[model samples]
Target: MKSKKVKESVTIMTQIVLPNDTNPLGNLFGGQLLAWMDLASSVASKRHSEGIVVTASVNNVSFTTPIALGSVVTLEAKITRAFNTSMEVFVDVWVEDRSGKNRTKVNTAIYIFAAVDENGKKRQVPELIPETDEEKVRFEGAMRRREMSLILAGKLKPKQATQLRALFE
Candidate 1:
């Protein structure tokens, strides 16, 4: 859209569980929740980059609890670190039961996204500004993981590359 820059790219997304999203166990479908998380993370990355963003990779997604049909799920996503054309966003999933007293962290992940231009080519993304200690820690952690992904994907030499690459070779 615009070549704008955001000091930070982060957002919180939430959804109230609906009957149609529930499974036979009367709990929300894990797939559905994951879908929501993906969408939210994508949007958060875009907010920082100010362009069309695509998912490059998602790392370490773990579900620690199930969401009941009547509960509300909140997904917090923020751009952690950004390279020339890629940004890593950290996401944490939380659930609030209908009772209004129990809010639990149920899922967490680090998703990588690439900002793209209208021609569908990858482009540089905006930088991130960490405002809190927690944000700083998460950003630093994401950087480490991003480096590992580059090596695992062969974008960089697993043994020698300090910067993460986008390809395995």
Candidate 2:
């Protein structure tokens, strides 16, 4: 496993689902889960930069299971990549059984956030310190997506990365 810098200050803060956050069917609301994703993503961005982070996009949400009330809904977040002031955070929501038994993933998604200065101008984000093989794999995934996004945005001209950079830059 390749060990890289894992930001110790990276926190999963201010957000965990509790019993009172459940719905009529005793399942936690999906919107609430998504909201927690945003929080986790912002925390990851701040951890990477300690600057104001604003969400730029959310890729997709896949719900593999329902979240039961009274169960622990934990949102784990990590910065898989950084570009200029933008940081990509991969978040996963899991449910810990009431008996403290096992955990199951309920949802997964990717979030993009841009760090800004006090005047709201974009600023540079700190580099991500990947610590393990898992982190390295995640970093590669983020980089692939970033490249794909550039291609889709017409920023990365096919077969001419240098030219594309010069043009876009």
**lDDT score, candidate 2, position 122:** 91
TM-score of 2: 0.78
lDDT tens digits by residue: candidate 2, 1-169: 2222546435564344576777788877877888888988788777677768898777767766877767777777888877777878888777787776988877778888988999999987767777789878988788667665667667666565533454445
Estimate the TM-score of every prediction.
0.85, 0.78
lDDT of each: 0.80, 0.74
> What is residue 103's positional error in candidate 1, in angstroms?
1.4
The clash tally of candidate 2 reads 1
The most accurate candidate by TM-score is 1
Worst 10 residues of 1 by lDDT: 1-10
lDDT by residue (tens digit), candidate 1, 1-169:
3333233556888899999999899998878977888898899898888779999887888766778988988998877777779988778888999997999998888889898999999887656666678877876777678778876677757556555433334
